[model samples]
Target: MARWRAAAFAAFLFLLLAVHCRGGKTGICYGRNADDLPSPDKVARLVQQQSIKYVRIYDTNIDVIRAFANTSVELMVGVPNADLLAFSQYQSNVDTWLKNSVLPYYPATAITHITVGAEITESPVNVSALVVPAMRNVLAALKKAGLHKKITISSTHSLGILSRSFPPSAGAFNSSYAHFLKPMLEFLVENQAPFMVDLYPYYAYQNSPSNVSLNYALFSPQSQGVIDPNTGLVYTNMFDAQVDSIFFALMALNFKTLKIMITETGWPNKGAAKETGATPDNAQTYNTNLIRHVVNDSGTPAKPGEEIDVYIFSLFNENRKPGIESERNWGLFSPDQSAIYSLDWTGRGNVDIMTGGNITGSNGTWCVASTNVSETALQNALNWACGPGDVDCSAIQPSQPCYQPDTLISHASYAFNMYYQKKGATDVACSFGGAGVRTTKDPSYDACFYLDSEKIINTNSTPPPAPSASSPSLPGLCFTLLLPVLPIVIASGFL
Candidate 1:
């Protein structure tokens, strides 16, 4: 009886851990300090279309806040450093600010957290000193409104807060900033909010080329890993090493179990002439691997199987920023709402890579149900592809040319490939969530002439471009977003 009880408890614990990770799932930063950007509503649409669930914005811009109303996107708003003094000095100021900035958009906005000041330790001593007081006032105001329980309160930090971080075990906070941080840490513990910190392995590698291995910083599979002498833990990627450094630093400060949130971590897509590793390919690799790491829930060596919630920095590239070229290029999307590169949030299954600089897909392509995919998923995908997706389902209908033996798998294969062909044969088009997979083998049968991948890719014989909203719309046919190919949206035509 005792053994059975322990087994049941262990199973329950595993499920609980999964739920926690889901709550702390990956999110993106929506910074709008640029001029040539899309309207907040369109941006909100783009975010949802990409299936991103959580977001962190620099401030509670009314336009952006209004945009996210009633959406599934969980938001974390900020109290900029400029407002710190006023917010800290008066509770009334905080109250008025919340009433004006937050309350009106309560349940609709889904504002889960309030980040009071970003990277305060990086600010001047006067400003840094006000962060805690400002946070306290904000907390008080939230309590008064009965929102304290629902909305968490915390601030972001730079890794510079830690003075010693080389060996994972030796990490410690900088003595100069301890006075500002100790209370902040105490408040976070008391409130049960995560300690948000900005971590950039790109800058770490860029700054110290002589010492940092480029492959390790890029999270390459072939990179020889670093083994911490004290902990004897091997760190192949710079991301894990950097995270564990803060973990140890917190442990040394006696806050052993505080949760850490990676508020900002991303690679720049472009940079100056001297920026060796700041190319599009490297950025793709870094971010793709980053997603895979987080999705797999592969925690640091010090905390294996633990959850590490992350928010990639900057949704759209900023053009007006005053910094190196790389600073302006840490965006997943361009200013035009185009994706910088394709990235899967869950990183499940294999990514479809374009070859020879052509997104027409590789030499050959076929679409079929993915291995181990559920029948229910395949049936839904089949319905979407044939019905709203507007594929030529007549080929698979009864007594038709493609229909034979009449299996769900057979009907799905025909529809999936047809839909893939219609969408210009882009790799992402073939992904019907996880139910569909692209293959090189032709699944065509006698009298059922299916188009090859190359036929769709050819400009001369390809289908006409998708019509605009004002133009005659194709019934049930899903089209890709017109710009640099982006992520898959929920309720996609392909699905």
Candidate 2:
């Protein structure tokens, strides 16, 4: 009996951990090419409040690195292009730099990746030759510090490196970069570091609107997907097509197993008249859908269910960046730290207008099952909500206060609202693949009260309401007792 209890307890713990597992993670880039941006400390706080887990910065400025210390946020620091030649010339240069900038606040700040340079291919100066040497020196320094395995070393590249990207299977790199890329690809494969590239579907669409549709670029549900004739695979979004193109490019070079990471990708919120696709709505739509696609493990047609880590191009709009109007407006937030528009980092597809750095919504909004959808769809959504969605459905079980209604809609409403509130009451949380709907009216009954965003602001503090007096409350007690056996039941398909 003792051994059985211990095994059951272990399974229960494993189940709890698995509930929160995600296929991919979304991170944001923190660029400070502006004079009016907030201090790093404030920026860190804002990032934490928004539940962001990873941040990439251009350089390892001490103040900025120190600001993220003792925080959950992970840092991906970089070596600027200007300093690449110096670092590449000598390992001692990288050693000294790491000793001062990294060794002090490494584990505390959670510094993960050290990107050597940004877009060396696009750099005005011909510093492409220095990239591999700089990377080697950085790797040697990390090995000396016993951090070679802990921290990854790579450089960011622009799409310009690829000579061909259309019909993804035919993707190939430019012949001119062969010498630089071969050695770099070898280093990446040996070190097991991902090939980091900065992809911008926004640019692809902007430069050639007739070739790339706005819906295809935005990951819109209504997109009439483009078909790659060579591979016979239909691509629903430009992002996936771009990713698969890079994958094929790596395969072309015999680096088939190399992982790809999106070091930067985002849409601009504003642009000149000619830049018609650059608007706030388009930006929000592209980012929101991108987050959903990534977090949900919707990989490209070429590589189904491949996990990719993507960092949104920018954190704030840099007033200092020189280019077209769209170049200066790629930030998710303004310089003042207010969100340009809300984003649901959880990938629940909820987006709303944010004001004064707080997510605002109707006070009484609640998610319930839609009457218009078919009952079968509702059931499927309900099953999803209770299963993978991680919603608690104990309140709707027999003998509970909410069990009196005993209807599919009532039970689903409880599960949907529970999920909606748990996901910060975002509109997309109520979507449930179009089987759920949001309403401003209260759906509470005699003792079965429904939760809204306002009521469950702090989910931890507010527990579910107790059962009514007439019921013995045996269901709740039984659930608590059976919690340890849940994993066993689920694994056996007996739940």
Candidate 3:
């Protein structure tokens, strides 16, 4: 009896472990720029605790991989920009990179993908040219280690690759980059690897607040939205526009079969005065909304019902990150492994980092955590806001507004509706107000309604026939006078 019980216990444990490993392919960018973050092992615990099954590290950090050993988390490691030039010239360099940086952590850490270079287009060096050769060498090295099929090799890109990307359908790659891009696409298609891009709609809005709608960019519940002339497809959110822009660019390149994965996409919790859309409210709005869309396996307008995979930009903010303040502030968590923002992936609210109500300063003066609330409370909050069939926080608000809760819900709804409407469904205008309507009211309905009384009741492409004195009928007379006076009525607010 004792032996049978032990065997049964072991079998149950194996099943539980298998279920944990099958959590899907969602990954997080585990950037290490801060000095005070929890150690790699502790960080591993945090990741597992949060149910984050995959991670992408910027470099071949041995400690990180080793810590993840024997666990289910999959890792996609990077070969830094500085090392690419060397790997490009000599195949041996890539072989060594594999042996020293990769194979050592194999089987244990589950290193699934290796990025040859990071954001080569934006790199200062002639790194773009080196990417292809380095990728080829890395593949060869992987084969040498008998780990070829186990790991994927590719490079990540920024949205800057698109020379034209406004309407998305009209997207095109820069003429200057076609030489390299053409071959790169061929390689990716042959290898069965995805083309990764770091997309952020927040930057677009920041650069052009006058043209980009805050709701559209931040995934708000507002905006009349713009229609793509070529596709007659309306874009409710800027993120979808950015993604489809890449799709259009690829299609134009004659590589329509290639898969595009978003490797990084998130908003900053802090920013300079000039950076208009970087507020916590907007960040919470963008990320929370983004999470809802991602969990649903949402795709871009051009590829509806497709399961588009994306990795949120980062797990924690790094004070050490150089450049604009926003660079150091894009983390979903504070340095101490506490969530900087609350996400609805688990289907409830705790303390959302974007709101700063549940998040607090724990890692340092600048960091925050959701330590005050109990796990049950956090889970309940998530269920209330995130669970399927649950009342959408934005749609079913209190009859009387609770300033904090209402605003958070409004922002969350905007982000969720914008992303889903654009990516999941065929109706774009339905997600966004058709034109000039603006309101953040619900998940399924536009807050603002189109109210143009001057417009004809029905869409008529041709003008009506002229009425003669003898043939002046009551219906024609009334219609002619009504048409002329409609503009005045609308202007006078009497319609």
Candidate 4:
């Protein structure tokens, strides 16, 4: 028993050191686009605890930089799209940015890469034209400062940049961006920096659920594989296919030697209605398999035996990220810094994944505030459930079926469960700032249906359209609760 314990401890240390040495492919993207997340210091500690050595932030926030300082984690800092024009035009601005942002905490921070802009092709700002110029200027500035070789410089592109990618070999850049892409490719090759791209099989499968196999998108080996006729490469998963497509695209452009780094790739563990296969089951499968696949150092078919670096889409789900619900739900850890899923990262269970709140595909479900939860926390969550969280809370109004009992607890429970059910009955969704709890016991009262997973509103039963301002009281505000009294109380939480 003593020998086993000693061996386990040594193995754990080795896993951490291995991750630190290579900046493992199992990195996390730290997105701060939310309000309720823990501070960077806490999050950085969480990253180290997970033994995650690579981190990519969407922008160069010094707080985040300082959080990872002296922690031996490799970081890829970003330059927001808004700064692209300035970064492209002025060598002085790049110098100033590097001096202020990069030099101050660099070696201690393990700042490995500086991603100038993210998904430039997908940005509506036409900043795609400024990417290479910005990169060139930044590189020049880094070179002038003697940190050029130390910090690799590049920009992240989306898979949307590919015009043709299905066959993998036929992958080519969209003709429209030839002006921007060619020069950018040249810069990456000359500087020996890797080409970074955000790839999402979730988006691919979600967009074409009918034709694409859900199992294949989730990286399940049981999937009916697709064969690329040109290379005779049989792909059991969409991740390898998407990656090989870029390899083919780069080779077609004669930039065969450049490294490929996946800047962001993840399955959203939850998403809004109409998004098929976005669940904890699928997410855990994709991410777990991705980590194993990367750790095996088995490169994609096109780039055989080569290791590629990848950063997972996010560390925490950002509540304020705009777009579909999936945009806000691609987190590995809950906002409270709890693991939402488990992984045998070291093959020894050295990392204890949090399993307390992983409620999925259960026999039943109920969302209720814990007995001792704070009224203030419950009220804020109630506000979120109704307003931006988009719980259909109309039935909880004074005159409605669910409003028989006027107590805040009763009304909040109804709103919370509705939001919870709509969010795939996941315990994380029911987390109303830790005030909420998931229960198997039904809390349904008279004329009120406290839904469980079994009682899910049929997929065909669409939620009622949100009340419009022109006809109703307000545009974005929720019309649930005792309309007058509830909205006033909820507004104070925001204040």
Q: What number of clashing residue pairs does each candidate have, in the order they appear?
A: 3, 0, 17, 0
Work out how many backbone clashes candidate 4 has.
Answer: 0
Candidate number achieving the greatest lDDT relative to the actual structure: 2
lDDT of 2: 0.82
lDDT of each: 0.77, 0.82, 0.65, 0.75
| Candidate with better TM-score, 1 vs 3 | 1
Clashing pairs in 4: none
Per residue, candidate 2 scores C-alpha lDDT tens digits across 397-420 of 999989978999899999999887
The CA lDDT at 338 in model 4 is: 82
Across residues 1-495, which tens digit of lDDT does each residue of candidate 4 receive? 655544554454354445433423668888888999999999988888888888999787889899999999999899999999999898999889888987888788999898988898888788988888899899888888888888998889999899999989899889898998888888888888999999999998999988788867765533556767785655667888899999989999898888899999999988888886777767877777677567544456565436788888888888999999889999988899888776545311111113323234434757886555556656766887787555788888979989878877888888888876755554334545445666778898778878766666464267667744322223221223233343443354411
After superposition, candidate 4 runs with Cα above 4 Å error: 1-24, 347-495
* Candidate 1: tens digits of C-alpha lDDT, residues 95-210: 99999999998989999999999987777645888999999999999999998999999999999888988887788999998777999999999999999999999998999988
Q: Residue 265 of candidate 3: its Cα lDDT?
A: 90
Better of 1 and 3 by lDDT: 1
Q: After superposing candidate 2 on the true structure, give the runs of residues whose Cα lies further than 4 Å from its correct spot.
A: 1-20, 350-495
lDDT of model 3 at position 343: 61
Per-residue CA lDDT of model 3 for 1-495, tens digit only, reads: 655544554454354445422322456788889987889999889888888777889888888889999879988889999988899899988887778877777888898888888888888776788888888888888888888788888899999888898779889988977767877888899899999899988888888889888878865444445667776665667888898999999998788898888889988888987886787677877776666455543345566435567788788888898988798888878887777766655412223323435421111111111233234322333342234312233433455332233443333433333332322221221232222122323223344211121122233337567755323223331232233334654475432
